[model samples]
Target: MAGTIQQIAELAGVSRGTVDRALNNRGRINPEVAKKIEQIADEIGYVPKHRKKADDTVKQAGRGKRIGVVTQLSQSSFMLQVNKGIRDASKKLADQGIEVLVKENASVDEAEQMQAITELEEEGIDALAVMPVDCDNVRVKLNELTEEKNIPVVTFNSDIVGTKRYCFVGLNNWQSGQTAAGLMGLMMRGKGKVLVITGYFSNSAGSRRVDGFVEELKKNFPEMDLVGVQSSFDHTDEVEKIIVNAMSAFPDLEGIFVASGGQAGVKKAFDKLDLHKRPYVIIYDLTPKNEKALLEGTVDFLIDQEGYDQGYRALSILSDMLRRGRTPEKEYMYTEINIKTKYNLN
Candidate 1:
């Protein structure tokens, strides 16, 4: 343990010059000598110029602090926008000597989302920004990891209530739902029947959206009727079939409001049933499919929640809490409920 340079060379059976060169990067050495020096250093736990050396090694690795982003944006335009925000934020942070690493997934399920989080943990990341799959079990597991691992976790878009999280960044879901219903009532002139398509109702965001929409519709639009409600499970096939049935049952189904990125399938069902020709459709999240639907007069309006802003802000807060040790504020960020008509769609 108290080996001098001479002792190291003697024990390594190499000249002092070779050992010095290998350790200090002063001169060229053969692979065999380099391997021997490395082995002896590891065995003896040699303390080299480690402080400066470690700093320089980390510096050479990249800019400043590194944070991991785990997201589920598979194919939704909403999630894609979130990714864009992360990229722009990462680039800007790099200018300030911080690096952002992102791993984007669009799988909106608990098992897959957990796997993504697990992988990020294994990567030895300093902090995390995630849009966790909103499930009770998944949330409990994430909270456990955050507290135990000392890894800062921020939730975007949906609420992971009652946790030791850095912060929750996204809109008031109830308000967003109310806004959608208000839009639908106005577009339909507060008359005729409508069908509501919901995402996973268990997720608070999805449930709150439905509650807000229903409450507002009941409060303001007395003449408007919520004819049927369908739980789409956030799947295309189910959405399509249910919409077809609802449209047939309510031929005068003047309104259709889908609660999430379930528009792709709903749009298809409407087109197949020629429901677009009869009803006013309000879609959530403007994926390319939904954008086209808006353009083709199939989807009347798309609810725009700045998912990109949510993703970026989540990272920004997580980074600050990590690097500067700042306490995070709730500062609930609401996605702007934009109605994408033809003019705006273009």
Candidate 2:
């Protein structure tokens, strides 16, 4: 710690009045006295914390943001929901002069995410909000962005450790998935073979949802056998392939779970196979497509996690951190999880 005013005054061989005025820039002190004090402090390597007024002035200068948002991919409804959240959050800060420039990777892979993040940096944004593709590389990238250019970052929807980031805002995925599984187990009376498909195991959110779903099944309804799990990348064609294949392999598959995107595809496969008659279906993300499926009874239950709201919450936290120096201490935020059935889908 730096010496107090008394010590500084004694060391500089000046009175405490001279030391105080010089340090505070009160302009009453002579130039010689101020120079001497500053020289002594520099020689001693003394740097002090900023006072409250000084801190507030600096933070107020950071209020209006020039922001860039990096997303996983643009194909899925889940990403669409998160984008909506960003828009709503930026709009709320519009009168305050904040601006958001959004960009997306074509896929959830290290190369794509790196490309998107790098492009966002080239845009010269003051701060960033991103859904990183890989936890390991993403953390390193974030550290580089912040340390090199002094740009702060916040992660939304997925988490990466070992670097500085502003915040993470997304669904409580495990709990949400567990809730989905529980709903499925209850609807089936805990005595059926269930098949669960996700976007991919590499993606953190999809993996967590699977873990939560399986954990919930184990804890809540062990009798319901979770037959097998597969990956879809949440695409219509890819998801169609998996769901159709799984339906054939698990002929007695009584219940279904789509833990990631591609809910509409799952419903479509079910319709084409005429399998909807037997297997009770539960998929995620209540977008317009899935909402329509819910209305028609093609999808039995839809766990609607509002992606847009997560974006809003994340941006709000990042803005507050940069502008007000307050970080969200809480781990997660609550998103809308609407369990919609055919009758109530409307």
Highest-scoring model, lDDT = 2
Which residue ranges in model 1 land beyond 4 Å of their true spot?
Answer: 1-57, 60-64, 95-101, 275-277
- After superposition, the stretches of candidate 2 with alpha carbons farther than 4 Å from their true spots are 1-64, 92-94, 146-150
Which pairs clash in model 2? 81-307, 81-308, 82-307, 85-308
Task: For residues 1-346, write the lDDT of model 1, one tens digit per residue.
Answer: 5456777788899888887766543433443465578678757766446324445656797645667887764565567777776885675445445567777765567777777777877777778777766677777877787788777777788777767777677767788889889999999899989889886765566777889999999999989999866787677888889888887787878888888756778667867876437588887776677778778877777777767777667766765575557756444645566668877875
Candidate 2 residue-wise lDDT, 1-346, digit = tens: 6657777778999988887655543323444466588667656655433333434554677644567888876777767767766776665444335567788766788877877778878876778888877557777889998788888887778766677775566777888888888888888998889988888676877888899999989988989998889888878777778778877888888888888887777766866788536588888876888878778777788777667666766666666555556656664555556677777765
Each candidate structure's count of clashing pairs: 5, 4
RMSD list, candidates in order: 15.2, 15.2
Q: CA shift at 253, candidate 2, in angstroms?
A: 0.7
What is the overall TM-score of model 2 with all chains considered together?
Answer: 0.76
lDDT at 213, model 1 = 93
